[model samples]
Target: MAPWGSAGKTTPRFLGQFSHYLFRYATWLPVLIAFNSYVAQVTWIRGPSMYPFLNPQYNESLRKDLCLVSKWSPHRNLERGMIVVFRSPENPHVTVVKRIVALEGDVVRTKPPYPYEHAKVDVGHVWVEGDGDKTKDSNYYGPVSTGLITGRITHILTPLDRAGRVRWWEHAEREGVQKAQAS
Candidate 1:
């Protein structure tokens, strides 16, 4: 009997397959994990919050927008009009995407559902809002700490017609918020 298996010269079939699986995964898993954690990630944007831009439609055909979220920006200062994905303050377990409407030290006249008529963004925090109304965002939760930000949406990669680079202040002219992102 061979030391590697049953009363035979060959290694067990299950053992060989298991080793191969481990070898394949062990060799690439760490690299994949690092790349996703520090570089960028692709995600499907769901819901109508950023309407006509991300997940445009709500009915059948239901084709959601696929986006590239750049993880590199969270360490730097974020500016107004940039779309961002962050941990929901109301529920840390969930993440939501919204645009920065007011930055720290900036004052904004907020709309209803947001208890106050005006809000001054405190240091280390920023005001965010969805392009679409009725979204559950800072307008509802108030300013969120910059520490909660996870990544910035840098591009839309799907639905061919809408695929392109997403500039920081591309939607600034759409209203509710109008400050252009500084270069």
Candidate 2:
């Protein structure tokens, strides 16, 4: 039999190796968690709510667009045409991604059944809409609290051919102009 503290023991060697890895992982786990929670993370985009900006074409395989979401941006810095990810006010468990159409105190046009053709965004609230005309958004659920916003999408990461920085502002501006002309 080997001595009590001898290096010839396989059990102690295995235990020591396991403990080293455990300690190393434990030390890094919190940092990883913090980064994922407050810095940035990858999010998968599904459905046609974002349409051409995201899931442009309908695929039977249900492949989704992958995006890098920045969690550190302040709400005050968010612009009218920026894309954002937020928790659905109607269902806390669901998350929705949409474009910011109006900020607090801004007047926005509304669709039917809202009692008013134009509505003013309330203080601390924002108006969000999907790129697709048929998408359900503020027009259906009304203005959402800015607090509901979780992050801003910074890049499209999927479909290697389509990977690039997200720049939809020009399109949004053109859409606004067209809407203005149509009205």
Candidate 3:
């Protein structure tokens, strides 16, 4: 007998058992990938633009905020002050998060670089701005094409106490965002 007595027999038995479970899980891999790609995904918030909301404790810490981004309906209706993640028009290589400040046809009060004092949001376009006002947003760049928005932020999943579903309507009202009328 070996030092562990059943060492030789246990090794082969363990290998056989592990392979069985591995094959069972293998069948579920594609299903998991599909769900992650189409239903929802977890994302990390990395900037100060959405401060005191997302990444609230990120100033000097390594603990960034994690949230759930809903991709269930790629073209779901969006309302003002609702947060979303989209491909950065300036740099397609990066993604950004911002709140919708104005919808199509709504007149927006322009900031410094946008030229005019007020401009109407073009059809299928939206004005997005960062909460912190320190980051580049619609006020810096022109309106974003709605097609670029990838997902709506639906929940915060980190920092323990703040983990829960976000209140989209309340945020919109608090920011004094005018509601989007159905076209």
Per-residue lDDT, model 1, residue 74, is 85
Clashing pairs in 1: none
Please, what is the TM-score per model? Answer: 0.84, 0.81, 0.78
TM-score, model 2 to reference: 0.81
What is candidate 1's TM-score against the reference? Answer: 0.84
Which pairs clash inside model 3? none
Compute the lDDT of residue 108 as modeled in candidate 2. 79
Give the lDDT of residue 45 in candidate 3: 90
Across 57-159, the per-residue lDDT of candidate 3 in tens digits comes to: 6678889888999977755688877998899999998999998888898777777777777877888899888777567888788899998988889999987
Q: In model 3, state the lDDT of residue 112.
A: 76
Task: Pick the winner on TM-score between candidates 1 and 3.
Answer: 1
Candidate 3: C-alpha RMSD to true structure equals 6.1
| Candidate 2 residue lDDT tens string, 36-151 | 76889898988888877788775556778899998895475767788999999899899899998877777777766467778788888888888876688888889999998988
TM-score of 3: 0.78
